[model samples]
Target chain A: MAVKAVKRIDLSLAPLVENTRRVIKGLKLHTICDSGNCPNMHECYGSSTATFMIMGNVCTRDCRFCSVKNGKPQEPDKTEPGRVAEAVVKLNLKHVVITSVTRDDQDDKGVFNFVETIREIRKRSPGTVIEVLVPDFGGIEELIETLVRARPDIIGHNLETIARLYYLLKPDSSYFRSLSVLHMVKEFNPDICTKSGIMVGLGENEDDVIEVMRDIKEIKCDIFTIGQYLRPTGEQFEVKRHVDEDEFQRYEVVAGSMKYAYVIAGTFVRSSYRAGEYYQKYQESRKG
Target chain B: MKEIILPELGEDIKEATVSFWHHKEGDEVKAEEDIVEFYTDKANFSVKAQASGILKAISVKEGEKASVGQVIGEIEER
Candidate 1:
């Protein structure tokens, strides 16, 4: 039986895209936008915002859905922080996002890189808000503290999928460890916003999604994002089914009923896409 | 006369600044040749000449912003 392919609607080309693409390349910087092939690249680049992927593009782990290359990563570029700072200044962004590939091979799992990047961004773009989306360090206290001490405005660790599917989808990562990391963020500094995101359409039910939401919320997570899991590459797991807009809406409704300040559920919503806009939106909502 | 309008850039960008002109009016330009470069917040783009012609009239000046669908210059049939 032949199944009709469902096409994903993509952003139309905008005049701002070329310039943003060139700038990211010129700065010798990497964005999760390009690395992950994020659906919101056009929207993010056009708006002059990007989630900068620091350290390097190669990851130590081969998460099933992630498109980032996995293998032997080169030595961490010492000058990377300076260039990231320069890119933040060049983009003139009010809120800057910095993320990285997992470097479990390293002694400290590349935690210091985040520390340096935050310091450099602060030094160069003094007014920019810094948000760091990180990986779980097996709940290591010292590693998590190193990141928290950086004092980024928001700390994000993505659960990526539900607890039941973790062994198959993200075998290398643990569901509970990620929750503990988010919990540690609030425990370390309640003022700094803690956030986590999960993906749907990987054969999980609504109950699993809600269960993850409740777990994260119990850890005092502030921002929760739920998006459909689009297989990043042909070699990755095929998309089981396209979770329609109505399901995403339902997820949003359920998540909003909970305590999170921001609950974004959409097909194209990623942890870092248009994150600055969400941050500002939350602040405005608070004021009201 | 053929008009050269800006192509779609990205969803968030409405206008872009003409950063520089690689070919000015009266310069013989080849089709598909990069004739001008534009700048936005993210990067620079060198727009290719749509048709081989004598660069005719440039309406958008250097250091000026051009909105999407706005004609920036004219190319005369050579």
Candidate 2:
């Protein structure tokens, strides 16, 4: 294994960053950047960009690699959609990403919040690009179709890890089911850009990684992201090994050649990291 | 002399941190040449030189932050 790469997190609190925190707090909203303890929080908030975690902070599934709290979550807030839309307007965001904690307890599996959030954003900020990073929703066709009908500019559901390690990292989720989620999106609406992401350094080999990439690409997923899996806390899954920078570049090159609309693979790349920029590139590719 | 101002990055992005300077002061540069790189929270952008000239000064050193439209550097035109 290569020597671990030392990464730094900037702790500076710029004005915009402060304002972003203030807005989220003032609205009593949750952001994955804060809930997940994302390394890029400072920089992202500094630019007035954030991935809003709708529904609630608590998740229904206990994915070992995730840092989100897993347990019985409160009832979904009916007013969340409007507040999220209000945040988009207050921040003057041109692009917005809305994600949620998996809500298996809900009757519709939390698709209602996603649909309503999309509706609210469209009504309030018509020009802002919306991307949603969602869970598999138990791979229910009707639930997936409901979200598809909402017509977000991009929809993402992370594969998280290779098929072989699926039971280990995300025991509650199925690898084939996740792929089906992306496939179903394209089936319902080919025009909506579909995306998926995975984390490395989870004890998967290069071949395993490539196999997963091929699987995602085979589904005609428009965008793919790969990032190093940093252990958010000692309680989460341990980092099996740190993937080298060169290896990450190799993955990007390999995925790029596979004809993905956009491929971002690196140590710090997250599902919604640079999502707006990737959406723009995907749009440009459609034009070309 | 020509000033190199940080152009509008995108909607809602009002500032960025200087990541690198491609050339040192006194180095000749061509118009539209990528002279410096800036990184916002989400993405990286390369700012090009406005005119062919010698990179005379860098007002914002690396790792420092600058808002949109701020003059980050200057060039002495040929």
Candidate 3:
């Protein structure tokens, strides 16, 4: 295990950070920022942006790298979709992100909430661009089609790590299943931007990271984000090493060569970090 | 004269409501003493006086929103 030190915490976002906190609490919402102990929470929330964790905070699977609580899941909140849409209006967000813990225990696998949430966002704030980081839905084709029919701007399903580490890291998840999920999204509708992300620094080398990128590209992924994985709790997997800044830059260069439409790779770059900005840029380039 | 501005509370937060005031104009306040409390969208926070002095001015009252970098109050050094 490597000794780690905290770096790059910005103190300037305090005032706005308060606003975001108040709204999330008042609305009774759960965010990955709070659940995963995301380091960029302050920066993202203070900017009046957050990735809303829908379904419920309790996850069905015990992924080793994640900090979201795992247990028997609760009944899906029926009114959640409307409340999420209301939050978007109050925040006046131009780009909105919605993700969830894996709810494998539920029939339909909580797909209805996702569809309803997207519809509510569209009906309430048609101008706000919506992005969803969804589960694999047990590789169910009909469920993927149901979500695609709702027409979210971007659909993200994180592979989370290299193929070799899935058994140890995401014990219940299969690397092939995740790749097929990305492929299916494109298969369902080619226009929706398909995205995925992975975390490095868990004893994987640069080649391992690139191999995942190759798989993502082979599936015709539109956006790829890479970030350093910080151990969220003492009990989770210990950090093998913090991939240095030079290594991140090298990954960026290599990923760029692979021709991902948008490649955001950095130590602090979470999957949805500055997501709206990249989507906007991708839209502009498409016009040009 | 030391101007007391709302300090950075958290990331990307833009505005806060003046939840309450612990001090009023002409009250002597010690440096870092809680003078006002603010309500943000997510949480509540108490702000401190910049330096020990008389509370010379109160620019924002309770239940009002203060934008970041706004001068909320002024402290006249004793």
Preferred candidate (lDDT higher): 1 or 3: 3
Clashing pairs in 2: none
Q: Write the per-residue lDDT of candidate 1 for residues A1-288, one digit (tens) a residue.
A: 112122221223355667777788898989888777565666678788888998889999988888789999999999999999988888888998899998888888989999999999999988998999998976798899889988999999999998989899888899889999999889888889988898887888878888887887788888888887776546787677667778789887887688564788877788887888898887776577
Higher-lDDT candidate among 2 and 3? 2
Q: Which segments of model 2 are wrong by more than 4 Å?
A: A6-13, A286-288, B1-78
For model 1 chain A, give the 10-residue run with minimal summed lDDT: A1-10
Write candidate 2's Cα lDDT for A5-120 as tens digits: 43333322345667898899899999988777676776688789999999888899999988789999999999999999999999999999999999999989999999999999
Every model: Cα RMSD to truth:
10.0, 7.8, 8.8
DockQ for the candidates, in order: 0.05, 0.04, 0.06
**What lDDT score goes with residue A172 in model 1?**
87
Isolated chain A: TM-score per model? 0.94, 0.96, 0.96
TM-score for each predicted model, relative to the true structure: 0.77, 0.78, 0.78
Best by DockQ: 3
The CAPRI-style docking tier of model 2 reads incorrect
lDDT of 1 at B71: 90
DockQ of candidate 1 relative to the true structure? 0.05
**Better by DockQ, candidate 3 or 2:** 3
* DockQ of candidate 3 compared with the true complex: 0.06
